[model samples]
Structures are given as C-alpha cells and as structure tokens.
Target: MKKNLFFALLLTFGAFATSFAQAVNDTVYVTINRLPVKVNPIASRDSVYAGQSVNLTVTNCIGTVNWNNGLTGGSVTINPTTTRYYVAQCTSSAGCVGAKDSVRVVFKSLISPIATSASICFNESTTLTAPSTCTGGTITWSNNSTGGSITVSPTSTTTYTYTCTYTGSGTSNASGNLTVQVKPRPLAPTLVANPASILTGASSTITASNCSGTISWTKPDGTPITTGVSGSSLTITPTATTTYLAYCTTNGCSGPSASQEITVDSPIPSVAFSAPQICQGDPITITASGCSGTYVWSSGQTTPAITVTTTLSNYTVNVLCRTTAGDSAPKKIKFKLN
Candidate 1:
C-alpha cells in the first residue's frame, strides 16, 4: 500500500508541472502605447491683476496636439479672469487619440486692494467699502461681514480685514485691511447769563462755555436764532420768560446741547426824591416814591427818610435804588438852607 501511495504522489506532481508549462507557452504579451504627450499649462505669473493676460504652455507633446479650446500648439496665450483647466490630447498618424492629459493653471490675484478708511463721530454709523477690483470673488470680512460693502458703527478705533476667495479652476485668497477712527464728540456746552432774572425787554448776554467747537443758539420756540451769530456768545431781548439752548459741533461731531432759562420780570420803577428846606442848623428830611427797592441817599443814609444838618447855603442829595433784578438810575434832589 505504501508503494502505491508513493506512485500516486509522483503522478500528481508530474500532472501539475505539465499544466504550468502549457499555461506559460499560451500566455501572450501585448504592448500598450502610452501617449508621449505631457500637458503642462504654465502661466507667465502665479497671479495676475484683473484684466491682464497670461500664457499657457503644454510641453513634451509629439505629433499634432489638440487643446481643449481647439488650440493646436505647444504654447498659447490666454487671458483668464480665474483659474483655468486645460486638456491636451495628441493624435497618432492613424488619427488615433492617446491617453488624455490635463493641466490646471493656478491664478493668483495681482490686485492688492485697500479697504476704505472712514472717520465718524462717536455713536455714529458709516459705511466701509472694498475696492471694486475685488468684485470677482466673494468677499468676507474679519468682522463677519459678507459682501463688498458693510456698515459699521464702531464705538472706538477699529481695524477690519477683508478677504476675497477665488474658487474653481484655481483656488486662492487675498486679503486687505482698513482702519476706522472714531472721534469723540465735543464736550457738552454750558449756557449762562450775567443775571438769571431781568425786567421785561431787558437784554441778557447769554454765553456758552465748556465747548470745543463752534456754537449756535436756539430760541425757546425751538427755532434757530439766525441773528448773524457765529461764536459762543449772543444777546437776546425776550419780552417774556424764555429758555435758550446752545448746540456745539467739532469735527463734524455734535455734542449735547446746553440750555438756560431766563426769567422776565416787571419793568424798572420810575422814582424821584425831594428835599425839604430847613434852617441852617436844623436837620433835613428826604423822601422818595414810585419805586420798590432799598433807597440810599447821598447823606450816608439808606432809609426812606434821611436827616442831615445843613452846613452850606445849598445841599445836593442823590438817591440810588436797587432790587433783586438790578440797580436803577440815580435820582438827585436840591435843598436850600435858611
């Protein structure tokens, strides 16, 4: 049984060897002609400004080569706004096309755009615009603004960056930045007058302070006082109690308005004083009426009636009146001594 098993193994081995030899003889080798054409589309520059031209070249191509755009040359000039894809295919003498080869031309942006800088008043709004040359790509800003333009209300000085993306064919991105300077508003103005209250039709010199800009006045009725005014001071004669406001501006920024109220009172009183004739050694009395104020006489007296001894043939007495509103014009009286 051992001898038979050994003979069977020998037979199996012989059969495998014969089949392998037959397979090797039957195998055939075929040659596939790979296209010798190599497409290498190159641009004159990595990036070009908008409205510029670039050259595309395909090298290592033999026989007649056809480009994607029916262009039949190793090198061709092209003006592509964006990244471009070019395919080059070469044909054999039998009009048979080889394996297609392709090239991607990367276009970089030659545009160095500068964002618009703006100056605005505090709490005010302004618009920031990107250069028009960057319109071909989608614009994105560091402030999360999308598009060529955005409105900004910056509370303080801020700088923003904008980026534009060029997609398809070739992919690239460019960025630009600008600064916005926010100027503070002028200090609030203060309105004041020489006297808080005055008689009717009295002129009050209204003045403005704590201002760092030109000022204009407004009447109580909210109408602008166009009385040829261009400074921080103005005088107004109001027939009744009136309030005035001052508006100040600096560098196109406006400050809070300052206001003051003036009270108008009754007109000044018209009063006169008279002196009585008396003996040379007798005291004299002075009297006044038609006025409401503290009366002061030239005889060193402040009462309504002042008595003084006559020391000369004639004595001149002057009386002055003053009230909360103001002082009145002086009145004089003459007395003859006996």
Candidate 2:
C-alpha cells in the first residue's frame, strides 16, 4: 500500500490528487497523493529574544502534517528562551511517514545599562559618565546633547538627566539623574589698625571687617604666619614697623585680602639746664625735654623739672624719661649749677 502511495503522490504532483479507501479486519486505510511537505528553511525571523515568537511554515503536505512535538499543522509558532528546532514530519493517509524538515530559532540575551557621577564645588568641574550600550540608538542629556560622557561646571547646585534607547531586536531604554552640589566662596576682609603709629615695645590693635565669617590674620610684625589665629581682632606688640593682612575662605575658595601697616618709633630723653645758674643763696632749676614721656631726676623726682637751693660751687643733676613703650636708654643728660 505504501508503494502505491508513492505512485499516488507522483500523480498528485503531476496534476491532481488520488485517494482510495479500503476496510480490512476493522481497519480502514486512505491514500493522500499531494506535493511533499517541506519546512521553510527561512523563518519569520532568524533570531528572537526571550518571550518573543517566530512563525515556522511548511507547504504541500499530503492530508495533514505532524510536528515533532505531536502538534498537527502546516505552520507552527514558537517562543523559546534558548535555541530551539521545530521539525515537521509529513505522513500519508496510509499512515506512511514521508518528507521531513526543520527550522532554527535563536534567542538573544537581555541587556541593561546604568549611569554614574559625583558632586562639585563653585567654579569647579566634574565628569559625568554613562554606559555606551545604546546600541545604534540615541543617547540624550538634559542639556539636549548626545554622547557617553560630559563635563560640567555649574555655579550652583544642579541636577542632570540622561536617557539611552536601544533599537536592537526590541526597544529598550535606560534613564537616570545626577545632582551636583556647590559650596560658597568666602570674601576678603577689611583691616583697620588703630593708632597706626606706636612706640617701640607697644601693642597695636588690628581689627578685621567686611567678611562673611571668621577671618584669619597674617604677616604680623614682619613675620609670616603659616597657620594663623582665627578671629576678628589681633593685638601685636611689634618692635618694628610691619604690615598685617586678613582674608577668609570656604570650600577651598579664597577671596581678596586687606592690609594695614603699623609704624614704630623710639625716642631718646634729654634735659635743659640754665647754663650753670649762679647760686649765691639763689635757687637752680632743671627741666626735662626732648621726649614725650615721664621723667626721672637724680633727686628721686618724677616731675619734668626740679628746683634746689644748694649754694654749692658745683651742683649736678641727671634725668631720664619713661614712655609707654619703654624707658629711655640714652640721653641721661647731667647739668651743673654754680
């Protein structure tokens, strides 16, 4: 009967089909003469992603066709996470199997992407980066720019957004946002040194102003202070003239500075005598001069002048001046009276 089925198939391919039904021992047999069934080597698609389906088609099968999985159909739809083969086996009405073919459907793996970044300071820049996995798709930023990495220098706190779309096999998109914080910068301080002129060994008061916060002092008394005191006022006892500078900073940003100079002076003491005043039952007077300070006399006096009635042939007196800064080191003048 199978031999006759092959002859029947030839006749069907030539023009029309031929079928013969016969019953024997409660078993019935029929014949189907038609074109051989062939599974199309080409598929709806060569490859598909997980949960994605593809159609497998076959043509010209006699009566009906059976897939390897026992499903009966001329076409099959398959969705597999892994590679799969859908085979079609054509059977004749006589129960004789004939002609077989298969098609392969590949599954692709899924991919996801992410973005990264950091914070920044005022006048400072930072690099923002994202994955380059757009895969023939467009990548756009909040600034309406396209690319993988970008540099930004924001004056204040800011937030940026990004999006990546992939058109591979399927449409995929990744999006995220980044924020950069900005720290403020400090301002320069104004300095004022009261009593700009001081005597040697005297202290001068330097004050700071016009700053956002605490101020730092520098260059006091002609000496550089690497780490200085933090305050608005600084008192310095300088032996010589010097310049003082002040400024403030925050978030590693520096501002302009203001300075004040102090001048120091040292004065000598002297005395004025009456060119040897005659003492014949007469009085002699000596006065302190030359320096704007307290005076000391040899007669144990603190006044600037002294009087005496000695009547001695030669009377000598000495004096010195004491200022706020220091005592006079020289000019201890001596005067004689006759």
Candidate 3:
C-alpha cells in the first residue's frame, strides 16, 4: 500500500510540471475597454501642407507596446511625404502577444497659382491686377512692379499681361488688358513726278514739298538711282532715246513723280572717194565719216574704210552708230564711182 501511494505522488508532480510549461507557452489576447480590441491606425488630418506634422494613434493589448522603432507610445507624429509603414507589437505578463494594425503614409503636392500669359509693346503703358482667389499670398510682377497692381510703359502699341500666383495657402491666376497707342510720326515725304518729253542725254529734276527725312530715287529699269539724298529734289539724266520714270521716296512711302521720253538721232555720214575716176580692175579706197561703228559697203566689204576692185559704178555705203546707253542709229553715205 505504501509503494502505491509513492507512485501516485510522482504522477501528480509530473502533471503539475506539464501544466506549468503549458502556461508559459500560452498566448493572451489583448483587450481594450473590455472588448476584443483592434487599433486601426489614425491619421492626424485628411489634408495638410508639406512639412506639416501628422499624428498617428494606436492601441495595444498587453505588456508594453513595442513600436518597430523600439519606442513605446500611444500616439506618434511624423512628416512623411513618402511611403511609410507602422508596426506595433504588444507583450503580456503571461508571455502573450498582440499586434496593432499597420498603415501606409503617402505625400502629395500642394496647390499653387501660376502665370499664364504676359506681353508688352512699344511706346505704351499697361497695368496688371492680381486674381482675388489666391490665398495667403501676394502678387509680384517680373518687371519689379509689385503689389496687386503694376504699371509699365512701352514705346509702341503694346500688350501687357502677368502671372497671378499665390504665395501661400491656395493659388490662382488673373489677367487684364492695357492698351497703349503711340501715334507714329507722319511717313517720310514722297515725291511724284509727271511724264514729260525731252532731248536724249538730257536731265530733268523733280522736287517734293513737305517731305521729311532722306529722299531716294528709282529709275524705270528698277535701278536705285540715289541711296539717300537729304534734299527733296532729285535729278536723273537719260543717255539713250527712251522713256524714263522718276519716283521720290521718304521713310517707307514712295510714288512715281514724273516720267519723260527722250529721242536721239544719228548724224549723216560723209563719203570720200579714192579717186574721181578709176580704171577697170584697179583697187580704190573709200573712207566714211561721222560713223561710230563698222561700215557695210554695197560691194560686200565691212570696215570703217574699205578698198574696192571693180568697174566704175554708183554705190551707196551704210554706217551704224551704237552707244553704250543702248542707242543704235543708221546713216547712209552716197558716192559716185567712175
């Protein structure tokens, strides 16, 4: 009977040891406010500016709540413009375990105002006003004109606009039109010449009145006669027998003032015979005068002076005068051959 009792006691001791080991490995579920608890991560605010701090609140079940950062806190704040995750684990006195839910943090850009269009012209001034909806910000012009309004002076017809930007909070844009009218000075003086008739190689002068700035002349052939002449009067000479036109120009304005037709006539040619009488088969020399070019003889000879070998006969010689000015005329020489 005594031996049986000892064995029973050993069994009881073994059961107790097993129960203690099981208790050490057991997990305790964390409870909050007397209910099975879950801590969904809390964000500080739905919307906030960059660099603003955001708070995240978490609840844990047991022991001390150990954050992934090795910190113990019921709440935390961070400025995260990037993807971030929060991990919290709870420890219990009974070696139990619990974990808070994790969350991701994301960053976004803030809204700001920007300028859309701006321009300026010469001899004119313009004013620009800022848009009203720009929050916590002021207006600034690139031209050093500040405040909600600015002014600029341009030399000509101009357009002025500016970017409306908000410095802080929210931003927006606005634009205004400023018209500057600068009356340009009257266009340069122009001269118009009328058509006329004149002798070849003669010149005619045309004058313009009330003309400002330098004057220029153009020929009928599209050639520029004078580049710039200070006075209103311009003269052009005709070299050949042709119609000529003259135009007066000042600044950007120009018109035909006058035109003239000139005529050039060829003088008569003088003839001289080598001899008053010539025998058959004898060579005779003939000379012509008042001709400017090669001469053509009836005997098929070409020269200013030619020698002819033939029987006595009457012959006529033709002479042509040509000028560099594109002038050409013919003169006839009559002579007797005996």
Candidate 4:
C-alpha cells in the first residue's frame, strides 16, 4: 500500500509540471520587418506649349530618383516638342521601394496666319478676316488691333500686314500682307454764268472749268438739267433767279459740284396826264416814270414823256416799257376835250 501511494503522487506531479510549462510556452514574442513604400512621381503641369518646360517630382522619395529616360534626381524637367508620356521611380534610404508613376504632357503648336483682301473707295470702311484659328499665338493687324478680324477705313491704297507672335514653347513670328485697292476721285469743278443778270426772256450762258471728266448739270435737288446733259456750257432763259450746279464723273466716281445763279429783271412804267380836260386847241403833256429801259407810246412816240392836242371829245394813250429781253405791260391814261 505504501509503494502504491508513492507512485501515484509521482504521476500527479509530472502531469502538473507538464501543464504549467505548456501554458507558459504557448505565448511567443517576435520582431517583424515591413516592405518599403513605392514612389509615384507627379508632374507640376499636365500640359505646356511647344518649347515650354515642365517639372516631374517624386514627393515621398527621400533619396535618389530614377526616370525611365535614364535621368536620376528628385525632380526632372521635361521639354516636349509634341505630346508624350513620362515615367519615373524612386527609392528611399530606409530601403523603401518607389512606385512607378507616369504622366502625359500635351504640347501646343502655332500655325501660320493669313489675311484677306478687299477693294473699297477712299474713306470707305471694310473688314479683314483671318479664317484660321490661332493656336499658341496671337494675331495682330498692322493697325495695332488684336483679333481674328478687324475693320479699317484708309484714305489711300494701303498694304496691310498681319503678324502672329508665338507665345508657346516656340519663340517666333509669322507674317503676311495684303493690299486694299482704292479708286481716285476728281476735284470739284468751278462754274461761271455769262451775263449773270438779264431782263425777262433774255438768254444767259453757263460754263464750267477745272473739271476732271464729263460734266453734268443738276438742280439743287440732284435732278439732271435737261435730258442727256453732256457738255460744260448751258444756255438758259430764266424768268426769275435760278441756280444750277455742275459735277464731274469718271470711273464710276463723282466729285463735288459748283453752283451758280443768274438773275432776271422786268420793268413796268408809271404814267400821269398833265391835265384831265382840255379844249379843242389846248395841248396836253404826259409823263412816264419808274422805268430804266426804253419807253414807247401808242401815238408812235419813243420818249419818256409826250404831248398831244386832240379835237375829239375823249382820247386815250398807252405806253409800254421795253428792255433788251422783252417788253412789260402797257400803262394808259385818258383825256377829255370840250
């Protein structure tokens, strides 16, 4: 019985020791090493004009950077003449691996600019247009205007030049020119009227000078005087004051006109009798006034005043005023004899 108890105690102690060691050894402490972070490079700008430069940099990379194009640095400058893509990688000093990063850059180019031509009269306005769109450049006209189109009014024939200044990666200028043709205009003509003043029914002549081309006469309202006006001189019989102007035309262009006026005058006489009644042997005198031209009487007298003796109970005399152009209405006086 004593030997059996000793063996059983020994068995229980071994089991307990085994269980304690297993519970303690089950918990473990270890040191871990993590993989390095990859680097991704970013570009400062995604697009640039031709001949312009851009920068590509790796932000998280604390060490040397390598590009697919064999460039090594934290940042690299890219000058692309055309659209292209770029890639770069970086590694940190702490064994961090860099991620592959790529960016696409677009380049802008310039095209030659062109200008259109036109024909216009002097001092007339017209427009010029550039049909092509400007890329990476600005279009400027010789008149110092900026745009695709511009309007100008020039006095004489002119040559217009347009320039395109490249503001992109390229630094240069493209130029083209066109001419605007202008037609010449004649100078104003001078007009003169011969015998500027005349009596009624008298004809006067008008002449033109300093005319560049065919002369045309018109009234103040621009209506042509007479049909088919073709000469420089015109003979007119005007009853009152009248005005006429002459203009010259050539090559579908006309110049200013000169105007001239001719004056016409008419005269009428006034008469009075010296006595209203006269005896058979008595004499009577008549006087005329208010006329600077010649006077004629019904009794065949051509003087300003006349005297007549008549035996009839009643008598009548009439006088008329005459000018170089024509005669005026008659004036009459009556006399009675006893």
Candidate 5:
C-alpha cells in the first residue's frame, strides 16, 4: 500500500507540470509587414497635340520608385503622340512594395488647315469646306453654321471664317478665313447701224455697246458671221434687203443684243445709144435702145429716134429708165456736129 501511493503522487505531479507548460506555451504573438501607399501621377495637360510635350508629376513617393518606362523620378516630361497610360510604383524603406498608380495622356491635332478663296457668278452658289484633318472638334462658320461643309449664295462679294472648337480637358480652338468674290452678269449689248438705206453690194457699219468678251453678228436667215467674230464694230454687205442681229458672249453666257434693218435699193440701168457724126448743113439721126421710159432729144423731140436737120455746133441728149422699184440715176449722150 505505501509503494502504490508514492507512484500515484509521482504520476499526478508529472501530469500537472506538463499541463502548466502546455498552458504557458498556448499564448501566441504575431508581426505584420504592410506595403506602402501608391501615389497617383499627375500631368500638366491630360490632352496634347501631336509633337507637343507634357509634364508629369508624382507626390508622396518614398524610396526607390519604379515607373513603367524603367525610370525612377518624382517628375518627368513626356511627348506622347497617341493615347498612353503611365504608371508609377513606389517602395518603402522597409522593403515593402506599394500598389501602382497610373495616368492617361491623349494626343490630338489641327493639321493641314485649308481655307481657299472662291469666285462665283451672280446668283450662284459655292461650297466651302474646312480642313478635314482636324480631329475632335466642331466646325463653326462665321455665317452661323455648325457643319464642316456648307454652300452659300451671295448677290455680292462676301467674306467667311471658320472656327474649330474642342471641348473637354485641355480644350483648344482654331480659326481660318477666306473671301468669296461674286461677279455680276453682264448686260445685253446695244447695237447701232449706219446708213439705214444702202445700195445693193454696199457695206454698212455696225457698232455695239455694253458688250464684253466675244461679239458675233447674224443675218435674218440665222446665218452666223464666221469672220470678224470679235470686237464691237463690224461691216457687212448684203445683196438684198436684210436684217442683222448682234449678240454678246462672256463666261459661257450669251444673248441677243439688238436687231437692225437695212434697205437695199435696186441697181441703176444701162442704155445703148447710136449717134452719127455729120458734116455741116447735113441732117443727123440718133437712136436709143434699152429705153423703158419716155425719152426727149436735144431738138425737143420725144421719140426713140430724133433727126437734127440743122446743126451748127453741138447737141446734148439724155435718157432715163424708170420703173415701180425706182428711177435710174441718169444717162447723158452728146452729139458733135461739124
């Protein structure tokens, strides 16, 4: 009985000591390492034109900083030709990495600007187009237009200007101007003709006014004059009574000017007469042919043939041909008596 009690006490003491040691070891302590905070990058301009430069900056950055471009810096200047994103990663002195922060840069431009001058005729329309290369902008015209292209018609000369506006971050605008010249259409030409009445095969002077470019003349028969097609003055001869028309042409515009009528008279007639020379104290006879009207000789004879019984010096005779058209100019015949 004494030995069993001793062994039991020893077993209880060992179990209590083991339990206490386990209890003391149950309490735990932990240490934690956290990454540093990331700083967002800032740029001088979020949007920039092509071939332009921008400045980027980062704040609250600690110890070794790594950028996407393999460069370490607090501030940098970048020239971006397109949309780009830039990131910066910073680390603390305790050798902990932080989350990366980034920024975006957009590229744009207004290039190849064109505003050409224009010329148009009166009551005509012309189209105006702004430069098509400009991006991210609204085109506005001086005439209160909001389109890239527009057509305008002006009675007189006019001037126009176009403006391009870009709205948003890094907003920008540009402008260009052009002039449009409007020319008035020429008026009808005035025509004038000399010698209202002309003899057959005779030419008349023709003149025009308020005419420009090419001038042309046409007969009443609608036949155009091929020669002397230019200038404001010309001469033409017609075999019979004819009317003429004048026209002016300029810049693909042509119209009749005025019309003139010229009267052509019939030609004079010719006569053939025979007079025989006689000696003193001899009777002389004269005959006329192709005579269509009454005739009178120098001896007061009203016949086609006249005889002079007594001629001392000279005698004169005249014959005239007349018809409904008109009277001939006149023909004279003289006979010499010896």
Candidate 6:
C-alpha cells in the first residue's frame, strides 16, 4: 500500500509541470489595425502635353510591415493621368496583421490650344478667340492685343495668341493661338439656257460668269465635257434620255449647279397591211406608217412596202425605223393565210 501511494503522487506532479511549461513558452503576436495611403498631389494635377508622373507614399503604420507591391514590395509607380490603386500590408515581428491601404493617382493636362486658321473675305474683320478653359489668366497677345479675345482686319494671313492665367494655381498659364487667312469670295457662275429641256441627242450651253481661269463642266453621270468651246458656254449633249447636270468650275471652286431633262420620244411605229387575209400562193404587201425614216423589215427588206408570197398559216412582219434625230420605234404587220 505504501509503494502504490508514492507512485500516484509522482504522476500528478508530472502532469502539472508539463502544463505550466507549455503556457510560459507560447508567444503573443501584435497587428496594425489599418494604415492609410496618400498620393502627393491628391487627385488631379494638370501638366503639359508632354507627360508627367505623381508620387505616392504610405502613412499611419506603427512599424514596417511586409512592404510589398501586392506581389512582394509596397511601392508602385504609375502615370498621373491614369487611375490606379496602391496596396500595402503591415506585418509585425510579434505576428501582428494590418489591413491594406490604397491611394489614387491622377493627371490633369495644362496645354495651349492647337493653332488653327479660318478663311475670310477681304476687308472682313475676324475674331481671334481662345479655348473656353483659358480662364483666370492674363492673355499676352503676340499681335500687341490684350485680353482673351481680339479683333483684326486682316488683308493677309495673320497670327494672334492669348495667354491664359490661373490665379488660383500661381503663375500657371496656357497659350492659344489662331491664324486668319484672308481670301476673296468666289464669283457665281452664269448658267446659259438654264433648266432647259430637250429630246434625247440634244445639247445646251452653260457659261461661266466673271471666271478668270479655265472653265470645266461635269455631267450628272460624272462625265466631263470639253471646255475648249468657242466661248464661255459649254454644250452638254445627252445620248440617252437623261437628266443632265451643268456646273462651272474654276480655280478649284465650283459654282451653283443647274440641271436639264431631255425627253426622247420613241413612239411605236404605226403599221398597215395591203391584204389582211390571203390564200396560199397569194401575194401580200406589208407597210409601215407614221415613221419619218426609211423602213427596215425583219426579213431584210428596207422599202416601205414589201411584197411577200404567203405559204404558211400566218405571216408576221416587223419593221424598225430610226429618224435622223435618233428617235426610233418598232412596227409590226400580220397577214392571215386561208
């Protein structure tokens, strides 16, 4: 009984010692709650058209965590115009964890207006204007004119500038320049026989008014007419019944256009026969009427009357006639054989 009690006491003490050692040897870890990230220029920072970049840094971290760019380190570079987010996590030696922080980078552009020119007539005044965004800045005109807008009576090509100022952002400025090209207005052309209508194969003339250069004419079908005619008039001949277009072109500028319609009358030829009915071996005559030109038969006969001997049940004669003016129609004659 004495030996058994001694063994039980040793087992109870051994269990207590093991539990106390484990509790003392365990480690406690610390973590950062949340760190804030910020970009140097806040959000939008306008620069020139060349290019620019913004800097970003991290703050609100008690200790340095794993400075990773999400992959490994905590720093990232990006274009200012582009939107991007920076992520960083904090890790402590005591095994503490922290939330990632994000910062946005943006770019705003401050550039001058592109140079442009407009055409104006002689003795006409043109206004030189700047872009609408050119505000809060004083315009230093290159032509000695002040303010964001300027007026000038230019007989030739002239250039002017407007320097814009942004008082809120110090001496930042944007320049806008414009050129005015002075030119005389083109003279309108005179259309001769304007809006004329004729039959097919007919022609009309159109003249250019006050034109110092060579005149050119374009038909509605995009066919160009010969400009070497006797005078300023252009003769437009249409082969087919079509709407013709006439325009005077000089010095790369075209005048007002005019159109004419040519109606071709190709009426069906009137036909007649000497004998409506004939017996076999009887002679029949086919005639074409109401046509001005010489008659042509399908049987190779060109006379107005063709004498034919009938043998079949019926005979059909077709005559085609064309006038000198290209007016044409077809005629037919039928003779019944009994």
Model 6 lDDT, residue 278, Cα: 65
| Winning candidate number (TM-score) | 1
Give a tens-digit lDDT track for model 5, residues 1-338: 99999999999999999999999899777867778778878988777765556777888777667779777788887777678798988887788889989999987655433434387777778888888745567888899977888888978888888777766444556677778887766676787777756656767777888876777788767788766443687677777777878877777556656788776665443444343345677665656555444554445565667655545767666655443334445567666653
Taking the tens digit of each residue's C-alpha lDDT, what string does model 4 give over 1-338?
99999999999999999999999899778845343346677777676644456778877766778787778887887777878778766666655555677778876554433334466766667777754634546788888988877887888888877776665443546566678877777777887877777777778888888876788888889888974333778888887878988887776677878889887755558877797666687787889986657888998888989998876667688988876546777887766554
Best by lDDT: 4
> How do the residues 1-338 of candidate 1 rate in per-residue lDDT, one tens digit apiece?
99999999999999999999999899678866655554455655555544455566666566667888778877776666677677777676556676677666665553333434477889987777777766467899888989888888889999888887766445556677788889999877887786777766677788888877789788757798978454788777777778888878998888877888877754433443344345577665556654455776676677767655677677677876666667656676666654
101: Cα error in model 2, Å: 19
**Residues 207-301, model 2: lDDT tens digits:** 88887666767774546454434367878877777888877775556666778888775555556666555546666676767666677777788
lDDT for model 6, please.
0.57
Measured with C-alpha atoms, the lDDT of residue 55 in candidate 3 is 68
Looking at model 2, report the run of 10 residues with the lowest lDDT sum.
16-25
What is the per-residue lDDT of model 3 for residues 184-214, given as tens digits with 9 covering 90 to 100? 4343343443323333454545565554544
Clash counts for the predictions, in order = 0, 0, 16, 6, 0, 15
Residue 91 CA error for candidate 3 (Å)? 43
TM-score of 6: 0.35
lDDT of each: 0.71, 0.66, 0.53, 0.74, 0.70, 0.57
Q: Native-vs-model 1 lDDT?
A: 0.71
Model 1 TM-score is 0.52
Residue 92 C-alpha lDDT in model 6: 47
**Once model 2 is optimally superposed onto the true structure by TM-score, how far is the C-alpha of residue 136 displaced, in angstroms?**
8.2
Q: TM-score rank, highest first?
A: 1, 4, 2, 5, 6, 3
TM-score of each: 0.52, 0.43, 0.28, 0.47, 0.42, 0.35
Model 4: weakest 10-residue lDDT segment is: 108-117
Error of 5 at 225 (Å): 5.0
Q: List model 6 lDDT by residue over 40-153, tens digit each.
A: 222233332113343344444445534334433333334444444545666544546666655444334444444333666666776766655654456677777776566778
